[model samples]
Target: EGVAAFVASQGTLSYQLEHFVDSHDLLGRSVCSMGSSGSKYISSHEDSDSAQTHEGVTVVDAGTWVSEPALWVEWTHTGRLESVGETRIFVIDAERMFKALLHPGLRAVATQYAGEFHKRVVTAKPPLASYPSDIEVPHADFCGIVCCMAHPWRVQIGMHAFRKLAAAGGFGTGIAAHMKSRLKHEILTGRSVLVVSG
Candidate 1:
């Protein structure tokens, strides 16, 4: 279940969940276009081991597309939704989540790894910074209170959700681990700050 918001004709922001459908219609589809072989995009099914079908994928632009091989995770949608003012929050099914994250554009490594081997090997490509350090944040003015906020309550709730999922084992652990690492880096470096508004 994923959350999405759209403005209704009446100019009201409405939110809804992309409700999960327990279908394997897209189970074995090849997400990458280079060739018709490699890891199949994840499905709604719980057994990721059973869903994997190994083949070969020809990496077109290996230098830029290849990323370090890692384990693909499968998670169940909790089917829960939360509303915080104008924000509606929900968890997406593993299939959609993995598809978005493991899209070829993000992880371009030509070779795919399976099982425990994924953990030991790292990509030879040098890491590139996503953005330049000296970039400026554009300022915008709103005549009224445009209450976009980074509420402490929301942060705590997100942290708690990650922790809960992580405790459930499997892919959640990876998600939590990555989230923690990124959060710590941001806090220590002060590279970005969440603005709180009353």
Candidate 2:
């Protein structure tokens, strides 16, 4: 089945199972453009009749455009032409492709083999530091507190209803637990705390 049909029937695509297939001409052309020589790298003994080696590996910057669903991955290469050759673009389905890109085993392998490839390619240096400066400022003071005062009777009745519900175990205990944990964590972390005061 086509990807669209599969997605519609399954309600979601398993990004992990996606694969890219390219002809040798295309692959060589892409690699050459990147200024790198292209050759299948495999151990001699590892090649077996039943096993398909490197069938599922997705190549980035492969000079392929995906127009059906409307997606593409931007890419670039760094290094001299002698060291690193051409950079080709690869088409990708953005939303559905993230799972494939972020697969656990693939992530570890990419990290090790690619050697900080993620950081090298994805990291952006912090903006240049600005020097501290002091200048006179116009005096403008505006202070206001939003005070919502509920009627005493209404507050009492609401509290009474909450107490009854809690006592009966009819209230959502999970939500309360989560809130308590969050509040405690905030307090321990010395973060600004906002309380909904009744």
Q: Score residue 49 of candidate 2 by CA lDDT.
A: 28
Where model 1 places Cα greater than 4 Å from the true spot, the runs are 1-149, 170-179, 183-198
- Candidate 2 residue 80 C-alpha distance from true site, Å: 24
lDDT of 1: 0.24
Q: Candidate 1, 91: how far from true, in Å?
A: 24
* Candidate 1 pairs with clashing backbones: 65-108, 65-109, 66-108, 66-109, 67-109
Against the correct fold, how does model 1 do in TM-score? 0.17
In the range 1-198, model 2's lDDT, one tens digit per residue, is 111100111111111222222111111111111112222212212121222236532221211111111111122111111212332322233335434667674444323423222222223222321110000001100000101112332233334444565566754656677774554455344342222231
* TM-score (C-alpha, index-matched) for candidate 2: 0.16
Q: Which stretches of candidate 2 lie over 4 Å from their true place?
A: 1-90, 101-103, 110-115, 122-198
- The deviation in Å at residue 79 for candidate 2 is 20
Lowest summed lDDT window (length 10), candidate 2: 132-141
lDDT at residue 9 of model 1 (Cα atoms): 16
